[model samples]
Target: MDKLRQKDYFLFASAMYSQPISCSSLVEQATSPFVSFHQRLGCFHSDWHQHEWGQLIYAEKGCIHVNSRTKQILIPSGYGVWIPPDTDHEIRSTSSQTNIRSICFPVADNNGSLRQTISVFPMSTLLREMIRYTNRWNQGPVDEAQATTFLQTVQGLLPEEIDKAVIVYLPSTTHAKLLPITTYIQTHLARPINVQWLASEFGLSVRTLSRLFRQQLGTSFSGYCKIARIMRALELIELGCDNVSQVATDVGYESLATFSNNFLAICGHRPLQFIHSKRLY
Candidate 1:
């Protein structure tokens, strides 16, 4: 947290965004209670801040990670975070070319049903298209009638609760020794991962290393490695690295069939299907 930067206000659009519809236009849009920021971000993050408006911070390309003190939400491409008004959180981009679509709505637009905590929602074919359509809608100020219709459509499409978003419960501890090990697994996904091999390389007995993973992370070393590989693959895919065979090799699977099987098991979509279905460009 100490290493991160925070902005006083995240609701306003940054210069990085180049939407045909200017941010100012939306701010003054008639009865519309929402305004949005669409931009491609470099390697930067905002300080913890909250506003009277609830928000949805998303990445059209790459991944966006949102964290509160107790929880961390990974907004992998195709996923979005529904942050309630005034919820304290910090945001950072995992990639240099992270394209963000952040929307803010006054609390009144929540309809008294918005969840108090951060939650993930789906962008179905209809929902996804609506988002794009709305972002492009700049025909003068929106009236109360139009705003109500727009808001109703959005709320109807949103899920009642968080579904399958990748959320990890973070330990308050820095987990110094364990952190580097995970980083290695992510970076070296193309290589085989063996707990004994890692333990030996890191100068820890296999048993001690095993215990550390189980006790601190509540997951076995191999389990953690498996997830690390998949998460990395997801990132690469969202970043436009779409060749399944290439992705399989990059993520350490020698067999393409094996890779697809694991991908289906974890992501519920075959590698190629997932790649095509994503909103990535």
Candidate 2:
């Protein structure tokens, strides 16, 4: 393995968007397997992008918001996000402090037969440390063999299934009006949002928008919005926002009491209880 220069790294990262999709350098790095770790503090924006290779993104200290088409997933620590090749995605830091480590590797083929969406799974402490270690050792041959072994071990230990609560799919749609509405809901999750306002904004009748939600997303508009709120609440709580009431209000619930009730219904626990249980784990 050879340490990549700064220019080499940037050029490699850019290949994810280039045509005739290539990942040779990334594969060599993963096979020779020099891992590079990065940490970004404060809010940052990545424009809509696609990669020719698959990426594993883990939040080491805070939370990240990933928007891929109409579906959005909030990734907290102890969880890693998997993005398949060529899937357009963008990420943002939602917490005051956020740290993310990513490993990019080329897929063996571009068949598109397997899953082509984001997957979130639990990461053990050991796996986290191994990733960091691999990043530290990404260089010449002296550390190459050990790094390769560690990479294999980490990949082997990765969870095969995603948490049901952590996966959301954005259904592809052709309806022109629905795109802006979906994007608006995701960006303004903290604001009080209602169907009538959404309907009016898109020049859609409330009945029309409601039907569209069912037809395209396979869920009621309110149900989908609640799921979105739950995702936001999860991110806020993970960032040490201990005020459950404030978190609830921030996610657009009218009352803390109502938020608690709804959170229990969807997540099988109240907000505080979920946080407590996760801490124990």
Best by lDDT: 2
Candidate 1 lDDT, tens digit per residue, 22-108? 333443452456765666765456666666667766567667767776555566666677887777777776465677777676655
Question: Model 2: per-residue lDDT, tens digit, 58-130?
Answer: 7776667677885667676656777777787777664545677877654545334223568775565675666
Q: CA lDDT, every prediction?
A: 0.64, 0.65
**Every model's TM-score:** 0.69, 0.69
Each candidate's number of clashing pairs is: 6, 2
| Model 1 worst lDDT window (10 residues) | 2-11
TM-score of 2: 0.69
- Note the residue pairs that clash in candidate 1: 5-47, 6-46, 6-47, 7-47, 30-141, 30-142
Please give the lDDT score at residue 86 for candidate 1.
Answer: 72
